[model samples]
Target: MTPEQVLVAPGRRHVYWHSALTVVVLVGAACLAHRHWPVLERGAVRLAVADQGWLLVGGTAAAATWICAALAQQGAVVRRLPQGRLVAAQFAACAANHLLPAGLGAGAVNLRFLMRCGLPAGRAASALAVKGAAAVVVRAALIVVLALACPGVLRFPRLSAGILAAGAVVVVCLAVVPAWSRCRRALAAVVADFRAVHANPSRAAALWGGSLVFAVLHALVLIAVGQAVALPLSPARVALLYLAASSAAALLPTPGGLGSLDAALALALTASGAPGAAAASAVLGYRLLTVWLPLVPGLVVLTVLIRSKAL
Candidate 1:
């Protein structure tokens, strides 16, 4: 390349990488590693759980959400695979995500599974992409609901500035969404074929309803975790904090989003007036509930698949 071209390319590449690193660092600092221990005491855990029964309810709902998410994607290409198989594929995809790092394991697993099941790559990719988008929209909706439902929670003086800035940036990004060439095309295409997707109202409803339920399950677990550590916090407040912690972890590509979620949850709770140590302990317990809980079921499903020579 010419000297001028090299100089310009270097600057752009450096900027791109810097921005990427910044986001990862910011998320990590905000979301990973529950460093507080004072809040996570054994006695607190025993008493906290005894006070509420939401955790069990939330777990059941989360499992159901995964099933629904799988079915939703399957409904996209009804002719290629049976409903039951599609749902199984969903569990396998999630299982792979937990087993592998940086999101690679899940994608490869899904791709191979789809190919083995006789689906064209395009169809499989499209279906998964659609389901993923539905998840994001559902998450955003959940955040908005929590924010509105608990005004006291949203009115955090310390996080107030950051919240405003983030909200503004999100708003600007969404406003420019139409200008993204591929996004525009995709939107146009989906709009064109909306009738068919809506033809089976039951499937569409399941997908959306499943989306909301999945988000609520997220809220409930965090609230339970907080309670388990003896936090006197309101469930609504807990929901908002969980929203921030989960969002921060999602921004990171870390395996299990482990440290990030722990850190974020503990810090958020501490910032809200809980002792740091107690918050940290709760976060650890919370991570076990949110991350490892799904992993067990995922592994069991994988064992069944392998034994059947499905993998």
Candidate 2:
């Protein structure tokens, strides 16, 4: 076969596979929506009569998340990135993030954007690692602080024997196949990046500050939604519940934490004294502002960026 033919064949296969994956994800989402149609309808009806003012507040907080994400991304590396494209890329990345499980889509988009900005592939990957680590730390810290600030707001659920056993098994399996050298090297690189970023006081501030604010903004979205639905929980309590639920949802490798986050958030709210219907309504409104409302526009941005070769 000619070299051109060989190269074209793989590209064609990749396109076909990507198309198949998109179709599957869309079908899955449709099926999920259908299965939960009754619950969704109730939530929608409740949201229709919810406080519009608070709903608008939730929407504003949702929009700010992308900007905070961009700030954290910039702070991940020492070099400067194009501000406009960085914000645009974060917007597009949010769209991609919901299409794939875990954070793969968002990570891929950011990695590509960084490389396009002239960062080497390794450095780009490390930058992503740094940002992700900072995000985790910030989220965990917020959860602790909120829990403490609002005493008795969050109650940890009891783990079943089966779950405990399963977790132990998984831990043992992971321990059996430890890649110590690779782990050490990756950790070393991340530590070095952390040191380099902290060397610049501004970068350090942006890194930690952006990460902290991003998580807080997300929690604010939930809090506002709860208020809109007239949930009895205090704002501080609602934010604590959101942080706790979302942190737990991260364990499940669902796309943008779709099913997992929704279930966890609703359950947490209910367990924390919110009425079942109100909890569901608040969760629905939160998703509307953060995900559904932005999905189409974000996709358009993604398309524009791709077509313009900006991604």
Candidate 3:
């Protein structure tokens, strides 16, 4: 095989391997949790859902956030994604993230969608990579914002190391080699693409709008989770906890950051004044609401996109 073919071959193989391992690991985790799984399930079923009114409020907020995030994602693509298609693509990503372990399936589906749009695969890859990096920046900002906004975080010493390590890493990634040049030379050649997609105020508005809304809804999710666990933490604490835990989960290799999401959330909450069990329960519940809730829509979107040959 040619050199380009060699690079392509390994990536293809890795994708397949990651996808396969994700399925295997999920099954294994489930089987291992068999006995305690029931207890955990039962315990989780007893989780207190906020009042119907609040649930409606929460659900609406969440749905809106998803829509906004969809718009932001669409804004990233130079050739704009149709409203329906954009929403569908995001839902597919979300679905893949939850059901698939490796979390790259979302990127995989997205890359294919872009390719079908006549955009090269490299550009598609870069757009997603940029978003990934943006997420990292957002994460750091969240922590810093929380620390400055919520002085209460210093009360818990347990989270000190994790938070510090995270801040340090974020600084390095953004400050050091952005890696964008090395990542997408071919895509970078399309100079007008970014201008076409991002020059207008509307696109920036959409992205900032979505990102801010995402943060708000995320805090609300944490509040709902805190309520479920009887944690009584403030919104500020929850926000910081959310960022910190998610950042840690991003470091994990597990599909969708499953185990790590829960574990990190638990630790962060505990450090933020929540009891371990309750924090665990809250994290579990939030995952149910935030992660699994959009899954059905995602699957539907993916199926529709595939039928339309978008992927």
The model with the greatest TM-score is: 2
* TM-score-best of 2 and 3: 2
lDDT of each: 0.61, 0.84, 0.65
Model 3, global lDDT: 0.65
> Using alpha carbons, what is the TM-score of model 2?
0.83
lDDT of 2: 0.84
The lDDT of model 1 is: 0.61
Q: Output the number of the lDDT-best candidate.
A: 2
Q: lDDT winner between 2 and 3, please give it.
A: 2
Error of 1 at 208 (Å): 0.9
Compute each candidate's TM-score over C-alphas.
0.68, 0.83, 0.74
Q: After superposition, how far is residue 219 of candidate 2 from its true place, in Å?
A: 0.7
Clashing pairs in 3: 101-255, 101-256, 102-255
